[model samples]
Structures are given as C-alpha cells and as structure tokens.
Target: MRIRPVGAYALLLDCDDPDHVEAWRAELCRRRDAGELSAVEIVPAARTVLLDGVPDPGRAAARIAGWTPEPVTTTAAADRVDVPIVYDGEDLPVVAGHWGVDVPEVVQRLRDTEFRVAFCGFAPGFAYLTGLPEGLAVPRLATPRSRVPAGSVALAGPYAGIYPGASPGGWLLVGRTALTLFDVHADPPARLTPGTRVRLVDA
Candidate 1:
C-alpha cells in the first residue's frame, strides 16, 4: 500500500488488498474515535481509501503504516433510518416489466427494510446504498438523464440511492421522496453517513 497526497489535508491510499478495504476503514474509524490520529475523513472506495486532515502528510502516512484499524461496532451502526417514498416514479413500471413482476411487487421490494448506506459520494449527501433485492438488480440506461431531482429513489446494478439534489444521473429512477438528505443548515451537511442503515417506506 502507498499513500499519495491529494492536497494539503488529504491523501489517497493505493491499497493492493482489495478485500480488506472495509477492514482498513473500520480500523481507521476506530483510531479516529480513540483520538489516536488527527484524521478528519477516512473514506474507503472500491479500491482506494482517502485519508484526510493532516498537519504533516508524511507523518500521517507513517502512523497509518505502523498501525492497523479495527472494524466498526455493530451496536454503534445498528439503527436504521426510514425514508418515506411515494413509489410512483417514471421508471417504476418499466423496471417491473423488466423483472417480470407486477408494480405491486416492486412496491413491496422498495418497502423492504434490508439495505445499508454502502458509501457516500457522486454528489454531496448522496449515498450509494447496497443490499437491494437480488431479483431487482438492473442496469443504467444507455444514455444518462440530464437531471435527477433530489430524493429521487434510483437503482442501478447492485446499488440504490436517493438523489440529494437535481443533477444528471444514470440509475433507473424508481420513486421520489420529500425528505432532505442534505442540508446546508446542518453542521455535517450530509444527512446520510457511511454505515448508516436505510429502510424505504411507502408513503
């Protein structure tokens, strides 16, 4: 593994061990919670983890090199947030048709409360949710949309997300919600955090 500086405060880790990213992430979080590291953000991605906030990037890298992080506690991440949805999206019927199931089934699946905030990115406060029902896995359109309204529940591949704000998107839009996933007035801004659980509810 190698740590490359991203800027004055952030560094990107070129992690070779693909399967251990989550383990490394948990460890980093543990260190942060214990006040062992002066890191502000330790974000894990598909193959890289971004470590940020360091007075000296080299020292931070050395600290990380000498130490290993632990996994997040199940209790701390146990609670799930219910996101109310209307289940009336433009792509709802089309998604059902592709799955060979009726729209009602799609509604039930959307209402299923067995998903988690896999990660957050692509947009501020927009979380990449995982654990979608296996049969409902779908692909993005050949052409992405010009604008996806905030709180638009969408699914593409094995991931699901609610657009925090209107923007170009590729995921199949399934529904819309009125909930605010991001708020500039809030201290942290991003309403959904990684490891946060999500339960979709029919409005």
Candidate 2:
C-alpha cells in the first residue's frame, strides 16, 4: 500500500488490490465512528480510498501504514443484496456474440456468478459492480446513448452495473430489474453501496 497527500487536507491510500482498498476503507470508517479518527469523508474506489478533512495528513498516513488489512471475504452477511432481472435487453444478442455464447448461456452465467459493488460514481445511486469472470469481460459500446432508461442492467469491460435512473450511458444492456435502485426519500438513496454483495437472477 502507498499513501500520498492529496492537495492540503486529503490523503489517498493506494492499495495493492481492490479488496485491500475496501478493507482499509472499512477500518477507517470504524475508527471515524468511534471518534478515533476525524474524517469528513471516506471515499473508496476501484483500488484506492480518499480520506478527506484529515487534520494531520502525515500522522494519518503513518497510522494507515502500520495497519494490516484484512481479507476481503470477511464482508458481513447484511451487506448482501439480490436483484431479480428479466433477461430481455436489446443488447443480449450482442453480448452473447462477444462472449461466444448463446443468450440462454449468458443468462445462466449472470445467475451463477457473484458480484460486489466496487464503488459508486457517474451518478447518484449508480454502483459499479466487479467480480465478473475474465472470460466475460467485454468492451463498452462504441457510441454512448443520449439517454438510458433507469433500471437498465448493463455490462462494460470488467464491471456489471445497473442504471439507477434515466441518464446517458454506453455500457451494453443485458437485462433490467424492477426494484427501485434509488429513492430520494430514503435515508441512503442508493440501494447498492461499496462492498455490498450483489446477485443477479432471472425474474
């Protein structure tokens, strides 16, 4: 792991892997909750976590350097969320072609594989899920759509994601769920947060 100063108050922890980054983020959040660490925001990404509003960047970096990260599999059971999907997307055939499989096989693969939310970005309530098998990785669409409908389950590169709401997108759509992924009235608007386990199943 590597720690670097970001501007004046933020410190970024560059982890060896995506799992390590999540472990570090969780530890920092625990400390923050117990009044051990003063952090305004703890943002985790694909392979890094940003600690913002830190009083002493050097001291924070030192603490993190000494902290040993835990294995990623230790995620709590409460973090798991299953999303039911209907495999009737416009790009299903395209995705099958890319994977060298039939449409039914593509659906089966989604049902069998487990995925985790790596990070949330691009839009509010939009979670980028990882854990797709290497063989299933496919490139994004050559041209992005002007507007993609909400609840559009899609794939791009090594990540699988659902469009929380109508917006512009480029990822190839494979399926969609009826579950409301985002709710403005809810305490936490996003249904999928970082480290949350996600399973896509046939509706």
Candidate 3:
C-alpha cells in the first residue's frame, strides 16, 4: 500500500488490488463512523481509496500506515439489491463464444454469481461491479456502440456494469433491467453504492 498526498487536506491510498481497496475502505469507514477517524468522504475506486477533507492529512496518513485491513465479510441484508434482467442482448452470442459455453449456460452463470459494487464511474449512477472470476473475464468490444440504452447490463474485463443512461459504451451488453439506477430527485441518487451486493435475476 502507498499513501500519497492529494492536496493539503486529503490522502489517496493506492492499494495492491481491488480486494485491498475494499478492505481498507471498509475499515476507514468503520473508524470514521465510530469517531476514530476524521474525514468528509471515503471514496473508493478501482484500486485506491481517497480520504478527502481531512483536517490533518499528515497525522491521518501516519496512522493509516500503521494499520492493516482484514478481508471484508458479511454484507448487511439491506445492502443487497436484486436487479431483474432480461438476457437478450446483441452481444449474448459473442460472450458465449468467448466463454466456450452455450447461451443458457452464460445466463445461469451470471445468475449464480453474487456481485459487489467496486466503484462508480463513467457516468452518474454507473456502478462497476466485481465478482466474476478472473478466468471468466471478457474483453471490451472492438467497436463501441454509438449509443447504449439506459439500464443495459454489460460486462468488460472482470467487471459487470449497468448503463445508467443512453450513451456510447464499449462494454459487452448481455441484459437489461427496468430499475432506475440514477434519479436526481431521489434521496440517494445511485442505487448501487460501493460495497452493495447485487444479484441479477430473470425478469
């Protein structure tokens, strides 16, 4: 792990991998909620956690350096979301060919996997979910679509994602849901925040 300064009031922790990032983020969030750490935001990304709005970045960095994070376990039931999907994407056959499996097998595998939100990026309410085994990782499209409809469930590398709005994207689309991923008028705009567990079920 490496701690780098992000301005005078924030610290960016570069973790070894996504697992490390998740572990550290959880620990930091726990400490902050318990009044053991001071920070305005504990944002997590692919392999890093950003501790922003710290009053004393130097002290916080030093403290964090001495700490070790454990693997994350036990997600609260309320944090789990079931996204209903209809698996009839244009790239469904392509994905099955890549995996050397039948189309039905692809859907079954997806349904069996329990995914977790690693981060949110690309666009508003677009959560990058991780859970697919490394061996099942898929490549991005050679040609990205000019416009992907909102709620498109897609996969790229080892991450599964849902397109929150109509936009150009390179991820392999496999399914879609009717659930509103982002709503400006809602209390919490994004439905899949980091650490939330997700299950994609048949619509």
Candidate 4:
C-alpha cells in the first residue's frame, strides 16, 4: 500500500487490489470507531481508498505507512443480502451466445455465484459487484440503451450491477429484480454498501 497526499487535507491509499482496498477501508473504520483516528469519510473505489476530511494528512500518512494489513478473506463477517432476480432480460441470449452456452446456463451461473458490493458509482444505489468468475465476464453492449429500467441486473467487464433507478446504461442486462436499491425516504438510502455480501436468488 502507498499513501499519497491528495490536496491539503485528503490522503489516498493506493491499494494493489479490490480486496486490499476493502480490507484497509474496514481497518480504518475500526480505528475511527475506537477513537484512534478521525475522518469525515473513508471512501473506496475500484483500486483505491480515500481518507477525506483529514485533520493532519502528514501525521496520518506516517501512521498508515507503518501499519500492516492482515490477510484478506471473503468471509470476514459482513452483512449478507439476497436479491431475487427474474432471468428474462433482452440480452440473455446475447450473453449466452458470447459464453457459448444456453440461456438456462446463464441463469444457473448467476444463481450459484456469491457476489459482494465492491463500490457504488454511475448512479445512486448502483453497486459495482465483485466475485463473478473471469470466464463469465462479458463485454458491454455496442450501443447503450437510451434508458434502462430500475431494478435491471446487468454485467460489464468483471463486475455485476443493479440499476437502482431508470437511466441510460450500456451494461449487458441478464435479469431484473423487484427490490428497491435506493430510497430517499429510507435511512442510509442505498441498500448495498461496500463490503456487503450479496447473492442473487431466483424470483
């Protein structure tokens, strides 16, 4: 891990992988909760974690430099959520053809795999999920739809994601879920947060 100064206040933790970023973010949160550190936000991205609202970036940098991280593991006691999906997407056959498999195989592959919310981006409540096998990674659509409906479950590159609200998208849709991913009236709006474990169950 490398700590780099971000402007005058924030520090960015450059991690090797998503696992390291998540593990390090969780560790920082632990420190913050224990009163060992104070920060306005410890934000995570695909390969980097940002410590915003830092009081002393230089001091924080020194502390993080000496800190060692434990081995990263998937079963680190995180919140698990099951999302029900209807495997009736327009791109079902497209993905299957790309994978050289039938439609049912596509559904089975998604149902059997365990996923985690790596980070949220693109739109509110839109979670970029990790844990899809590399063999199943599909490319994004050649032409993006003018508007994708909310609750659409899609895949792009190595990540799987849910469309929290109707918007334009290019990810290959594989299914649809009934769950509301984002709610302004609800506490903490987004249901999927970083490090949260998720599974797609059949609807």
Candidate lDDT values, in order: 0.79, 0.88, 0.93, 0.89
Tell me the lDDT of candidate 2: 0.88
**Runs in model 3 with CA error above 4 Å?**
none
Q: List the residue pairs that clash in candidate 1.
A: 27-69, 27-70
Q: Worst 10-residue stretch by lDDT in candidate 1? A: 69-78
TM-score of each: 0.80, 0.94, 0.97, 0.95
Decoy 2 TM-score against native: 0.94
Question: Candidate 3 — number of clashing residue pairs?
Answer: 0
Runs in model 2 deviating more than 4 A are 74-76
Better of 3 and 4 by lDDT: 3
Strongest candidate by lDDT: 3
Error of 3 at 85 (Å): 0.7
Report the C-alpha displacement of residue 5, candidate 2, in angstroms. 1.0
Candidate 3: lDDT over CA atoms? Answer: 0.93
Q: Tens-digit lDDT track for model 2 on 1-203?
A: 88999999999988877778778877888788988778799999988899999998888888778877666784666778989999898999999999999999989988888898888999999998988787788888899999999999999988999999999999999999999999999978899988789989778
Q: Give a tens-digit lDDT track for model 1, residues 1-203.
A: 67788988888877654335656776778787888777877887756888878767888788888875554344333477888898888998878987899988877877864676767889899887876656667889889999888889998877889999999999888899999999999987987777677888876
Candidate 1 TM-score, C-alpha based: 0.80
* Clash list (residue pairs), candidate 3: none
